[model samples]
Target: MDHNHQDPSTGLLTKEFAEGLGQFMAFASNQETTLQMGKMYCPCPICQNRRFGTVRGVWKHLYSRGFMAGYKVWYSHGETDLMVNFGSISQQNNLDEVGEQQGGVDEHIGNVQMVEDRFRVEEPKFEAQIFFDMLDAAKTPLYDGCRDGISPMSSATRMMSIKTDYNLSEDCVDAIADFVKDILPEDNLSPATYYEIHVSGLGLPYQMIDVCIDNCMIYWRRDVVRTSCRFCGKPRFQETRGKSKIPYKIMWYLPITDRLKRLYQSKHTAEAMRWHGEHESNREISHPSDAKAWKHFQSMYPSFAFERRNVYLGLSSDGFNLFGRHRRQYSLWPVIVTPYNLPPSLCMKREFLFLTILVPGPEHPKRSLDVFLQPLIYELKMLWDYGVEVYDIASKENFMMRAVLMWTINDFPAYGMLSG
Candidate 1:
């Protein structure tokens, strides 16, 4: 008479419910198919060689694993419905105790049974708006190309519709914003000045005036521009003068001085700067002679002077002919410079310089003056005497050279002409 006395540990499903679930698993399994060794095959457990022999095998597997107990089963047939609650095995002991007060084991089981009149599956329905709403709340909204199933939210078709309706996603907006912020007056100064110094100090015999403007320098010999790889040192042409030679050439602009500043001012820049400054100090001592050399060079080579207040140094080569030419032919490298700081006194006094030396042939001697060699060596000596510190240097086959330098005048006499 005590309902609580029923099996308290293994709260198995009622016999009728277990049979119904077994039938459903069997029906679902029979619908799957497979391919084996170029032949199509049926995937039903009964038709395949596997441990699970039939649809009933799968149902028993699910039951032994405890998925059937206390689960809800909803069946509907044209508005006629039935809901069966199979109390979970883990909750069985408690239910048994409660059942004693309401009725016995038979009564409790009857209360949770589903009626035969309700036994149909509902068709699946899509909810598009819900998906789109979730996408709108994302931190970074999806772009247009993303609508073609390339974005994170692409799985939700409704979200793609909303993105298309708004026309708000554009790939280049962020890049343009970055560009505008960089070209501002305050952000563009340092690289402009440094670029000018490098070009002049290198004795390149060319001018680059506008550091902030992109692609300001142009190579006169389009043919020579098409040779070798500048960064990777790969040969680009079979012969310097032959049509087979690759034109090794490139166009360069000053580093984005103001753009870099704006970049640093952004939230991301702060964290990056902190890490870089801590890990590596980019500072160096400036030399006085380098400053004088630049001044003298600028005076002598007026053609190389840029009309703009700042300049940037950069290099590029015509990829087709880069490897075929000797070092001397590619000596006229482009340089970039931009301005930094303001107030003539603080900004004008700063000096930036770079040097590039191209050695011709593998056995070229130490004193060999290949093309623009004399002016470059003279500049180096002048920079050394004035106590300028060298920052970087690089050289390679067929004559490619590059160097960087910085200069400053410390404790100028009060009456000296350098004083404001």
Candidate 2:
């Protein structure tokens, strides 16, 4: 946040702070709850809200000492918005990002939780934490004075891109961040190091379910117990966070349910997702709607076709060597799913092609591939039967959105494996 910034023209407090000060005084005017009955906690640098002052006294302290650095979030006041975790929340963790001479540690769970604790009324589950992170990151500006519409999440993504494109080291990234931060205005928004920028949340969410090392079976559903593989009797174990060994290797399952919901949430693609239903494609076979299978499925299940927003999806899988041709002898199988509801061009676009599952392999699973597909299949069933609550952007209404897997896109070997 922009702390201690002065308006160049007036040589006084920034427009934001000056404006906020008025609101703070107004709120304190009527509210009886404060550091004292007739006084509020002084948020100025001299008092740091630990000292109480009358409205006039508080104003004088702020005018002389300036508001405490990074006091954008009014947590002491009655505001409990998600962004209130900023500035003071790190008091429970490290505060080097606020320009402490001792330097800063890399961003970690402790630091995150310390900030997050300020906003939580009760203990949040894993999903709730993720939701808050995603929400806050999206709402937060890239920096205090950012006007480009970029956010911290987008900034982290761009940093990742540059790091990969140039193969920069962590130290090099730190140096670059330091240089950029030095040149930029003095604000808490620009992190000093790449480590400090720690990007996380729903940006990359994938389930790591236990799987049989031999790909014989996945340790899911009723088999969540059992110390060994059901089919081959091979031991499946991995160390948990508590250092306890648990059965099963791993298979990455990226759920498509949330991705589908986001399609309707975004204004950019919400309209495009239903383009096939709204626009006339004629009989020219430009999209999947012009194909026989799409029409056949619609005719057979008119109830499913009744909702124009209901998604039709295509599932595809392929196997490829993980280590190019000759370095390491290992393969990887990736299962991708795409919606057929989009126009032909967008349907094939990389952004829309969702990779739902990754079946690990020194070799392909072959007939055992179904073992890794259990989660995807379960989610698909849920989408078809129960559906999910979604907010449509174009219609500006909530609806129960359903999805159906129309067909599979795969080579002959994959097709055969799936059938088996």
Candidate 3:
């Protein structure tokens, strides 16, 4: 089937998009929603009475109803109504008191007012309204002015330049904050905190945890909050100026599932994510999804291909001197995870690279990596077995997303430690 077709005007379906959609539909059929029908079924409201056997069907369903314009209307109004109702309720209480003072509070009048108030207050009780609203508003025009792309000058624009051009330090951020105090009050966010808030605004935030100095384990849940390392029995915090303390190493855990869902929430990224499944077929050396091994794997393990959105990840870790080997002996090991479902061209982009764990080191984790990898491994396994419930912005429905750690990427020098 010639699934790839690009509109001259909108340029919606390129080879990449077609390939991604085809691939997604292939696996989406295995999901519970579609599996029973033995054909791809779109849950979009427009497709309520229709069934399609191709990726084009899925694409059309999402394009037409996925953005949820109706849902957004209801959402914005509902929020406005709630705020209005709050003020109204307060006003009504005062009026009720006034009526009682004036001896105008007949029992029937009181009962009528009470009933009217209940109806007004309970009018916003359309549950699931917010969820649908969020889905509708997520990638809307509101994001364009704030974070879409680099503009000539804006708070976001300046922050981008400061981080890329200048030293990424607390003082640098503070200075920028001072510079833009009138225009945009940063409220003295350290660079780290600023980045955290920035990403969180996009619906992705990272969790930071202290790790064992020996790289033997991470100081995580069920392990004394800030006591000695459970495995090595070494103090979790190091002595500093007087009573001040600092962690020896830190581990950052980034939730993979939510971020993956965010990909679908945004129009551009969501389309780009389907690149792998949307690319032209019957071609050699096009993309990773076109590889023989990928097809063979799909054929061999059909279960893994059940969810088109299920991410296949590649993990990589290596240690490098913090300040060139000669200047300082200190080293840092950053563990990065990448989503391979995106087109190969985009799969390795810095934006798609996720920093899951940061292992501070004077030496490599070697042999101790297993201990530090506990959290990631546990999450991956749970994702594969149980999966996570994620909303589909296009289909206007929720589905389970399962992910797999397809492989690891590391240099020859660090291969032995990270491999097994």
Which candidate wins on TM-score? 2
lDDT of each: 0.28, 0.69, 0.57
Error of 1 at 419 (Å): 21
Candidate 3 overall Cα lDDT vs. reference? 0.57
Q: What TM-score would candidate 1 get against the native?
A: 0.16
lDDT of 2: 0.69
Model 1 lDDT per residue over 191-300, tens place: 12222223222112432211101111222233236334333445543356666633232222332222322322234332232221122223431422124554474456
Is candidate 1 or 2 superior in lDDT? 2
Considering every candidate listed, which one attains the maximal lDDT? Answer: 2
lDDT of 3 by residue, 60-139 (tens): 44433332223221211112355444532333334444334334312233445434432321111122344445445443
Better of 1 and 2 by TM-score: 2
lDDT of 2 by residue, 1-420 (tens): 236545668556676765555555554434435423455666766446544455555655554445788776665554446634542343323223222321221122243553343232323345434554587667787667788667766666677678889999999988987887788666635556777665533455677888888888887779888788878888888657877786545788999987888787666888788776656766688888877888898778765664668999989998998889788877799999999888877889999999999888787687988878889989999999989877665554456689999889888988998963
Off by over 4 Å in 2: 1-140, 145-150, 159-186, 190-200, 238-248
| Stronger candidate by lDDT (2 vs 3) | 2
Question: Residue 370 in model 3: shift from native, Å?
Answer: 2.7
